[model samples]
Target: MPAPPPSRVTIAFCTFNGAEHLEDQLASYLAQTYENWDLWVSDDGSTDNTRAILHAFAQAHGHTRDIRIIDGPRKGVAANFLSLLCHPDFPRTPCALSDQDDVWLQDKLALGMAEIHGEQPCLYGAQSVHTISDLTSVGRSVGAAPLALKTISFGNALVQNVVSGHSSLLNLAALDLVREAGVPQDIQSHDWWLYLLMTGAGSRVVVSEREVLFYRQHSANAMGAHQGLRASMLRAMRVFGTTYGAWIASNTAALRRVDTLLTPQARDTLTALENAPKKFAALKRLGVLQRYGIARQNRFGTAILWLAVLLGRC
Candidate 1:
């Protein structure tokens, strides 16, 4: 009797000026325990040796796996990722996103596929060990807590993203779900948008407690880790200032554009949030949030979020 062939996983990797640490990340992929995969890269106008390194890797390893590289939209990180995911040439398969500077654990792909192998739309996210430029472990990221299935709701995704894109995998059904919604306009974080889209469409979001990658934090990180007191203060400031409000507006507008794809409860929650600012009294606005069960992961953050609502920052 012949054993079944292993599932082929598609790696959707995006790069900008990541030549500094790109080689190490690519090496990690080569060392993966799961061998059945192909690489599809989108380079967003790299001014450095990023393109050269990518081409070199493809030339060297193209025989082992199918490697295809393309030009990106050059808008920004969010746009690059969305464009890669929606590219017609990208295969509809079990897919994982890759950051050019991060090193994945040997089992990153195997574990992700094991969890997301399902008939329905499913998104899988895992935690990571934070590392400095030299790959020395600082610690696990702050709020790297395992996500509970109950907490994975559209209401919570409205204000927070628990799914880390670099550590995420989307099954075929989830990929179809994303393509059905099409690429959104003006999204701040691709991961947050994925969280919103998955939960809104009533899909399953499964999380792994295991840390599956080394999330490298460097001076050139497009988005830094939210792991320290300084980072926490910066996040609070964003919540209190216009930045958080702008992000919320972007996400909500994108959701509105595809409301038909969302579940009935998700649509109701979106409407409630859109109308929250119109309520005259702060208490009434807070009541609307409380009624919809919208909250951040922790009480302190949730308190700050409520205060942001009072100040018209959300």
Candidate 2:
């Protein structure tokens, strides 16, 4: 059932030092076709003009029940975003996250709204128009329902980080699911964490027709493909072996301790880790994995990883 009347979706933005592209993002939101949404700007230790820009936008649209600037903790992106949801002013309202430097399409919220058929939070899967000078979509399609866990985990999610944080939308129930999932302060990215939480929590992740969000790229982004094959490969190796190994190990330990804390669904999802080691080892030992020119993202194998690194850039 779609939400009974009186419900609204909140568009929350978390800013660090995002002055350069903030105005562009604001303009995109201001032009959104859907009218039942609100804009929230939360600043996180920006020494730049992020505040001035957000304040000006809010000043004009704040009272219209469409925009507001919030003062909150300056922790990392994950923490800052949680603060946005936990803000007293932030009701148990539905929300969609926004990054400081991305451009949202006018129909971003409209499509998500159409999918809102119940009191359940509407969590969406977004397709990004990666603007690496020109727009190129990053991966394959998710079909009718983006949140289908079995299909997504089997390969849908394994192939690429298909869900863009800037491209998604969520509702209070979805946020509740996330909080119940207990995201760590040090998880990879908001999108990854959200993917894990949302899918694990049984929230629907839809791929909307809206091609909103131009994921901006510059050297400073935490991660992006603009680093080219060499840098991308190096980072991919570190993430796969050094960084991600440590991460999986840590999350495994935490998951074990918190097994009781998990929803039966979350427990089932995390417990599936029991098969990861054997699966990977079997693939390494028995599967006929072919050799390909290693891109930074090809985290194929440990030996292959070092070999690719030693080859002096892919």
Candidate 3:
């Protein structure tokens, strides 16, 4: 018998004024070891030559690969990705998220496909190699520590997002879970919401040990790749502010719409978080969060998160 055909994958790419590095990113797609994939890009009204570059790429590779370009929702990056996720023509295949500037390694798709398994609703993501604007290697985006599956829960997702959209690949069942949940309004980040929804619904999230792509960091990055003291301080401040509280409130309301979809434990945790504000003291709120196992990826981060909860910031 002939060898089994490779699993079909669809890449949901979102772009803005990314013409500078778009070509390099597109070229990386062509170099993928897994060739049975389609690229669907939603361009958010670019004034630069981004449209021209996309059209040229499509014209050249259209016969061999499924390359499509469509207008974005014109809201924001998260909205643009959400629009692509809900696109009528989006195929019911394994889907991966892509940024306009990141370069995927040759085996990125193959690695994700091998791990996803398609047995249940699952998400696959790997570490990325941080790079300068010119693709000069900096270091790994994440540390060498293995991701703890126990910490990969809705409770933790409510407090911190561990998944990077650019490195995420969702199986068909996982994709269906998000699609059925519907896009939430005023969502701060699409990847965060996905992490919440999937884990809340008891999906398996796999983090690969190998790095899968080069994450380009530059001045124009919406979310920079900085993880220094200053960056960490700023992030801590953001989490301790009213903005983060409002974000959680908005996300909670959105999750309520699909409350039936979440597992009983997740539903209870959500309820506990929502009710924490009613507690008289900050320590009480912290206790509630701790009881639910709401935590960040690292111990230091989790400590800061505890402080945020104690101050009623989260």
Candidate 4:
């Protein structure tokens, strides 16, 4: 008998006033080696010609494959993405999260599909090539480091996000898991939220060192490349300021809303973190974090996490 047809993948793409680089991204999708995929775009109040471009692309490709363009929630990036992920019409298939400004490599879908398999919920992420606005290559993204399985725990996910949304693929099981969690109102970062939810719920996360897309660095990027000295200083400021603390608080509350979905260990860890000793008792606060295994991926980040806790910033 002939082999079963490849499972169709759904691209959950979000857009907002991305007229400049949107064409390149759309073209890249069309050029994918794995052609059995549908496009679902949620345009979040684009004031430019973005909607026009999307309509034209849909008209061109709609006959050959499934293509949809829907209005977004107009809240922010995270809200827009969540709307797509939790959409009632979202297909029960592997879903790829996409950004409006990035250009994908030809084999992105093929490589992701090859790595993600089985009945368990799985999230797939790969390295990306960082480039300038003109698509000139700068270097590989910082996510190129080899991922350690031990570092994928819920504790680490609390402080660090190992998955890049643009390069992420969620299996069918993962899609169901997200739907079960439902759409959250205030998510600081959709990718980070996914990492936390998936890890906490005891799902598989596969990361690849292979570069999958061109992560365009431009002024209009929401959370652009977090590299270089300037970016480092900005991050430091956030860590010490109320911003980082706010993000942690928001994410913690969001997880709490779906507390029952997490594994026993993860639920315990979350509770412990919530009940951690006051920051005024620096040593005790740090001890609590250590005891619960709440950590970041790298030594520097872990150190920063401890400092943040001590400073009442976490």
Question: Model 2 over residues 191-251: C-alpha lDDT tens digits?
Answer: 6656555544455666554456677655766463322455456655664455654544454
Lowest summed-lDDT stretch of 10 residues in model 4? Answer: 141-150
Candidate 2 ranges beyond 4 A from true positions: 1-7, 120-122, 132-150, 154-161, 181-183, 222-240, 250-266, 272-314
Candidate 2 minimal-lDDT segment of 10 residues: 286-295
List, residue by residue over 52-76, the lDDT tens digit for candidate 1.
Answer: 9999999999988989999999888
Q: Please report the candidate that would top lDDT against the real structure.
A: 1
Candidate-wise lDDT, in order = 0.88, 0.59, 0.84, 0.86
Candidate 4 deviation (Cα RMSD) = 1.6
Model 3 lDDT tens row, 61-129: 999878889999899988899889888888899999999889999999999988888569998777888
Q: Give all candidate RMSDs, comma-separated.
A: 1.6, 6.7, 1.8, 1.6
Better candidate number, 1 or 4, judged by lDDT: 1
Cα lDDT for residue 294, candidate 4 = 85
**1-314: candidate 4 lDDT, tens digit per residue:** 99999999999999999998999999999899999999999999999999999999999889988999999999999889988899999888999999998999999999999988999999998888889888888877664246533467788888777788889999999989999998887778899889899999999988788889999887766364645666656666678888887888889899999999999999999888788765577787788788888887667667877787777777
Model 4 misplacement above 4 A: 147-150, 222-224
